[model samples]
Target: MAMTEPTIVPESSAVSVSVSGAVVGGLRDVPTTTLADLLGRARVMDVVVRPLWQPVPRVAGPAFTVRCPPGDNLMLHAAVHRAAPGAVIVVESGDLDFALAGGNVCAVAQRRGVAAIVADGLIRDLAEVREAGFPVFARGVIPIPGAKSAVTPLNRRVRCAGAEVDAGDVVVADEEGVVVVPAARAEETLTAARARLAQEAAQSLDDWEKAHRNRIDALLHAGGHEES
Candidate 1:
């Protein structure tokens, strides 16, 4: 028997909010560290899921969530073709023993206009993926390829690298790490991040140091550490 496509849940049931270009652009400008501060540590992905190659450009887009079953990569491969251009393909799988994807898969995803691939599992063909300049942030790499028999669906909630990601959530990632902005708060977070960025830009290093030092001194004083 042939495998069938995963059933997409009705849109009415799952409210997929569209992320705007302004949000994407603003997020790309801001740092993941800044977003981490804004979103808290829980919103940030684990440090283990880092860029395969250093100096990779930051990617920001609405997530196209994919859930690949353990030991199988059927859904992730299907996602490249289904995801819209500028979508960040986020895969949720804890399978470390097998690779979820390889070089060609990354290339195809890139050619199809995917912003990047953030996987909790491993991938093969590190050299080829790096040479192609495709962005892949995952646990690590493995030589053995994963079987593509486990058929799952597209656009679903998934947990990738300790962060729960829903479809259409704003995904901002770069060298630092990946951060997911909930769809409902995408614009709100962007405005706040931009404001914080602007404020920081206006202040000089000396100004920041003085304020930072003062804060530490006050906290220490409150803690009963008397000034000598």
Candidate 2:
């Protein structure tokens, strides 16, 4: 039998996401916590991947997916240029010891209008990035930079942190966490999330407490627990 090589995503693959602007925009201001409630725990990224800096702005956009095997970060670096303006660069990184990118990489990405960088691994130069106000969500920071020799696919399905992200998936992240709305469900998810936000906004704290208490009591009763 002959072996076939895996297809490498084109160099220009960063401009690849096809999610509608309306859907992406609708999700932009939606909190990741709310989206997690709607999408369930499975759609949430692992807690390890969090905003690298405090007071970081929330970022939401169509995902430009990239996969970089451990110890190398070629694809992520390449993605900085290829991703569309306002696109969120989502990286599936296998390297933890090496920093995927540093201040310069982030600066260039920001300059190019890339909305943000979401890496399932470490980054470096946090002070510089924070000073520049570039939003980055990652595991942590490492001073050692990763090599750029390994080549991998871009704009493809990627397992980022604990979530499965595909090209065009709507990724919304904030201090709460990162939530991926599957590309196919972007429009409907936005609709439902907005509705939930409206409902929450309309409810008073007392009303919310009353409803919450009732729901908890019903669950407790079902579990055969009695309130004393």
Residues 29-110, model 2: lDDT tens digits? 8999889999999899999999988988888988888898888888888889788899899999857899999999999999
- What TM-score does model 2 achieve against the real structure? 0.91
Off by over 4 Å in 1: 1-13
Candidate 1 lDDT score at position 62: 87
Q: Which stretches of candidate 2 lie over 4 Å from their true place?
A: 1-17
lDDT of 2: 0.88
TM-score of each: 0.92, 0.91
By TM-score, who's the top model here?
1
Per-residue accuracy of model 1 over 120-153 as CA lDDT, tens digit each: 9999999999998988999999999888777666
TM-score of 1: 0.92
- RMSD of each candidate? 2.4, 4.4
